[model samples]
Target: MSDLIEVRNLGKTYRKATGLFNHKEVIALARVSFTLQAGETLAVVGETGSGKSTLAKLLVGIEQPDQGEIWYAGSQINCSEYRKTNQFIRYIFQDPARSLNPNQKIAEILHAVLRYSTVLSFDQREQKISQTLRLLGLLNEHANYYPHMFSGGQLQRVALARALILDPKVLILDEALTALDPSLRAQIVNLLLELQQNTGIAYLLITNQLRLVRHFADHTMVLHRGECLDYGPTAKIFANPVHEFSRKLINSVQY
Candidate 1:
């Protein structure tokens, strides 16, 4: 698969209050770059404040970058507006419980997405909703239930269904698995890999979970203090890390 997403020279800075009238510019991400192919998983591992979330926000247009170019499916997107990438890129938050609307039934939630993103008729939208729910291991009956009715694992499946409904090219998971228990996380991981194989959707998994990174990621990019410290195949990074920080990181995790 060719590169489905290309990021080049991305940079982001935030200005925060330092004193009464003073502000300091903090660089959250700096000239970071990478590429993701169709059906591939690129795990971005970094400690807190390491720019992982910043990168995710930038890619999804939650925040505008200071300097960078992001190309998705061969089209350069305006990082300032999420609508520009709505059809190709989607984001699944860390807390699946909170990502969904607690007030809306699952069917209503899914229908809203279809209503805004597609031209499908009401019947078509209903059909698409059932299809998407089933695709994510959810049932049509569950569609009548509220987000609160499901367990943590089921909530995640609902969230995944919401994202998959769009047929996105890349699904950016910002610590998406951290909130789940190990068993659920493993199930979600396997489901994600299966979805990748079946749908050819790329995944950018941003998290500090090294175990997940080591096992599932095709390539891994390490970040430290907003800088790219190491990057390449997961096997190479584990067998022999290039940066000392990476060595320490890999050693911190078992297997």
Candidate 2:
């Protein structure tokens, strides 16, 4: 059980203009550090503006960190290199419908990822697409349907399919389950667990859902104002949070 992803003293800052020639520097993340083990889920719980999204963006190379380092598979991840070889780590956005192209059919959307990310032949790509569709419980005909034609759950499955098409070792789920209803959320959570069991893909789950964190994550990290307030096993942390902020967060959730 080696770590698949590691972050060391990670920090990020954003500057906002206040008045003419004046600016305010806001710390989006400050010296945050954690490790995601292979085949394990690490939930990052925090309120809005706690830098959860910022951490996700940095992990997926969407934004460069001002300081610190990220290592994947024991190799340092250069932001520029990551963008070119990002098949190893994928990101699934919170809103599947918005994340996907509304105008493109499902087949087109998936094929675009396959074409750009891999060197598979046309027939091979088609076979891969079919396989992914089946794995996600979607039919071949669903590929011809637009994103708008599918239900929220189905659209999320499609998004998952797109992320998995590249055979990534890790996934950054940025509030990926927040938009779904309770039943659908449970379904997706089970699906994620099943997928991880089968493929050994590690997950970095960023969300404020305490129930989901307790049920789905192996470990948890609590953030407050872009800093880590607590980090430990999910059960232990929930049972007895050492940090005041972590305790408050757990109490805020309705049983």
Best by TM-score: 2
Report the C-alpha lDDT of model 1 over 107-129, residue by residue, as the tens digit.
Answer: 99888988888899999999988
Root-mean-square deviation per candidate: 1.2, 0.9
Quote model 1's TM-score. 0.97
Stretches of candidate 2 exceeding 4 Å from the true structure = none
Best by lDDT: 2
For candidate 1, the clash count comes to 0
lDDT (tens digit, per residue) of candidate 2 on 76-158: 89967886558989999998888898889999998999899889999999999999999988999999999989998999999
The estimated TM-scores of all candidates read: 0.97, 0.98
In model 2, what are the clashing residue pairs, if there are any? none
- In angstroms, give how far residue 27 of model 1 lies from its true place: 0.7
lDDT score, residue 254, model 1?
80
Task: Give the least accurate 10-residue stretch of model 1, judged by summed lDDT.
Answer: 79-88
- Would you list the C-alpha lDDT of every candidate in the order shown? 0.90, 0.92
